[model samples]
Target: MSVIYGLLTISILVALVFLIVFIFSVKSGQYDDSYTPSVRMLFDDELVKDDSKKSSTQEQKQD
Candidate 1:
């Protein structure tokens, strides 16, 4: 019972710390760029590779 209580206390402290850090980060404009991350992820490397493979297959079939 005492161990569980201690764990609960520790978890509450950790949660508080994370909450403070998140608030500070939000105030610091860390979450300002709402569009760039979404757009950047949409243009990552795998799509380019998949597109090239598709085009190459299309060319081979045409040949």
Candidate 2:
């Protein structure tokens, strides 16, 4: 029936659009960092500020 054909066509179009978007994302490196980001967030940022403070203190000591 025509309704079945229309439904099939719409479904196919939606799938094709999703496929295109997936391909684009893969090409753009959207899926590259699958795990690193989660682990990165768990790590502390204290070392960064500590390093900066240490460097400044050393500079002051040198001067």
All models: lDDT? 0.95, 0.92
Which candidate number maximizes lDDT? 1
Model 2 agreement with the true structure over 1-63: per-residue lDDT tens digits: 999999999999999999999999999998897898888776657777789999999999999
The root-mean-square deviation over C-alpha atoms between each candidate and the true structure, in angstroms, is 5.9, 9.4
- How much does candidate 2 score in TM-score? 0.53
* Model 2 weakest lDDT span, ten residues long: 40-49
TM-scores, all models, native as reference:
0.53, 0.53
* Candidate 2: count of backbone clashes, pairs at least 3 residues apart or interchain: 0
lDDT, model 2: 0.92
In order of listing, the candidates' clash counts read: 0, 0
Once fitted onto the true fold, the runs of candidate 2 whose alpha carbons sit more than 4 angstroms away are 34-63
Off by over 4 Å in 1: 34-63
Q: On a 0 to 100 scale, what is the lDDT of residue 36 in model 2?
A: 82
| lDDT per residue as tens, model 1, 1-63 | 999999999999999999999999999999898888888887798899999999999999999
Question: What global local distance difference test value does model 1 have?
Answer: 0.95
